[model samples]
Target: MNPPVPLAKLLPVPKDLTGRLALAGGGLFLGQWFLGDLLHVPGGGLGVLLTGAGVWWLSRGSTPPRFQEPASLQGWIARCREVLDQFETLEPDGGVRRQQLDAVVQRSGPQRLALVCVDPATCPQQGELEQALAGAAPLTLSVARPLASAEGARTWPTVLQEQELILFSLAAPLLAEDLLWIQQLPEDQPTWLLVRSTAGESDRHCSESLLAQLPARWVDRVLVQRPDGLLRDVLQPLRRQLGAPIRNLQDTRQRLLRGLHQQWQADLEQVRRRRFQALQQRTQWIVAASVLASPLPSLDLLAVAVANGLMLREMGTLWGTDLQPDVLREAAGQLARAALAQGVVEWSSQMLLGLAKLDGGSWLVAGTMQAISAAYLTRVVGRSMADWLALNAGVDALDLERLKREAPVLVAKAAEQERLDWGGFMKQSQQWLLHATS
Candidate 1:
């Protein structure tokens, strides 16, 4: 069954202004305050013009208009088709086989393959991988096994010799040590390190240190996670749709005047602002939800969600769109409901088990949140979240508390030892989330 959509979750139309003379006087005074006191300007003429325009626009139209794209129906349809094609390539069992190195070679162009080993016995697809690449033309494959000669050591240079590319498809768990070795290796060739990550497995919380160690140059092409197998087919189209801005949001005056049979540029701009804000809110929600791999209580997940939300909201504001608060609230509620219904609790338990292997401290939780937060929040929003956290949750304004809380849970603990810091960390994170997005 489709999840229930609550009426309270709907975006609301703006209310009409009443008490004309009083309202006008108040607006005039507020305009002066913004221009003279806040902005430190001489007179309020510019403020008056802007304020009057805004009010006039809002008063005529109760809600912001919807955004439209620049393309016509045929153009948009073609774009959608293109997105579908790219998405199909990532699907599991989608005719693309790991044993068929030929497909990868063909797609990436005629280049030599860089092969690195993590001991065949410990490698996940050692035999199958070798067979696949052997037949592909114009490729030089080199192999090197991790040495047992030293305590916890692997010979890095042996793999670099005669190879123009490097591949890491190891069976062993990816760790910071392995990543550091890869980073230290000669960078003459473009490297393709394959791992078992997909969009669905992001929250598994495996070796993030490896992600942090990614060479700055290759960040864009790096496959952080695979697209969702189930949604892979639709992923590109979805991405395109989300990326496109709504047309009405960009030209509200035109949209509003079209309905009223007037040609007022002032009214059109106001309408544009409202629609833009709505677009921002929706985009924010989509980005956050797209990254989720079964929801967790960890601050990291929430931070990502909030960052996406904030970015969307800001984008809309810049375009003169007014984001509907109710839509945001409703979308959030839907997501929360979906997670609860889908047995996300079990998923969180599994993720926690995986994260427990990382050795870290009290600041880990906060640090994770900071990373996710930074991904979405621009300077303005980041400072706002930080300040809100400090004021409301009694958290350090610097966001260092994440480690104090989550790290201990990840620490090795005896069966009989109960965790105390766990509860406090969760509370702090929840508090910050509420304030940051509310």
Candidate 2:
């Protein structure tokens, strides 16, 4: 005979009774702190005592945790093996092999549930089948019936079809009340009903037809067996019960995940706003420093401004935000057209503003390709101004002239790099200028 498997290794005990008790006691103490001493209540001492009592009340249920052996998947494997060994004993030459059949059993609340069926039986493994029924957990061998009997095994199929609901027919006999206990459950709760009599007689039609009467969502799978020994169809009710709870839990988890995602998005937006503000402030400081060094004089500031706008196209590509290159190109074109119409040769803030308003310009342009490019130029101008201020506080006519001449070329290259539609950009620019001037 194979040696009995050790049960201790399969199940472990917990050992945190003291800590659990302390936590419970702490909660009570917190209540006293909140309600009595903090409020300067007359019965504060009484409240403290009551808090201690509350802790004691909670601790009454706290047992010192024991050190139990670890339970593993191997326990389930062993259980399966045990059922097989018992089956072979019942029928030495039984057509079924240990590998062919699987046994599953569940015990929850007051009922026992189990499943023992021929896995790949060409013919019924009658002897081993009887052994499986006999060896069910927590309930005695009841009955095994022939599958062919139309009125005999209807109840079996009604329960076994549920994929999630597990069953365990007990090794010990069950009373009628035990059968009624399981049968009385709402059709949605996965359950096992133990039958005591080994009699093969069962009202298959009644049991099966009654299953049809059950709510559609309540049924999963069912299994029926006679005391004599037989296989029945898989049941449906058990499956529904098993799947229902899991479905509800999944929905709850999904909602929690969505809420967390929204919170993360809000946090990211806040961080981005703070960083953008800091960058703007730092850029302004650099420009202030440059202006004190050498200032623009006798040069086309309007062209320089247009080139600065074009730089947005490059910054747009560098950063993945949808700061459009086309928009920046249009803005630059508008500045150029305004300069041309006004008989001005140089680009400047006033010339660009004449073409397009800058009222909400910072907000509208800051992240846009045009705005980013403008910001970059602002930085450069600021740095240059600071350097000039530090050197002599004098105007550099040559430097200003150089900036004006190079502005158009720089803007064109930036537009090309951004893949801007130059023709469309110019048209938009002209329209913008007309609106601005009007």
Provide the lowest-lDDT 10-residue window in model 2. 389-398
Q: Which parts of model 1 have CA positions greater than 4 angstroms off?
A: 1-114, 119-127, 130-136, 147-155, 171-173, 198-210, 220-438
lDDT of 1 by residue, 253-319 (tens): 2222222222222333344445444553344334333333323223223344455456535543342
Displacement of residue 78 (Cα, Å) in model 1 is 51
lDDT score, candidate 1, position 97: 29
Regions of model 2 farther than 4 Å from truth = 1-255, 286-438
Q: What is the TM-score of each candidate against the true structure?
A: 0.22, 0.19
Evaluate residue 199 in candidate 1 and report its C-alpha lDDT on the 0 to 100 scale. Answer: 41
Error of 1 at 180 (Å): 2.7
> Where is the poorest 10-residue window by lDDT in model 1?
409-418
Error of 2 at 98 (Å): 46
Q: What is the Å distance of residue 216 in model 2 from its true position?
A: 29
lDDT of 2 at 397: 24
For this target, which candidate reaches the highest TM-score against the unseen true structure?
A: 1
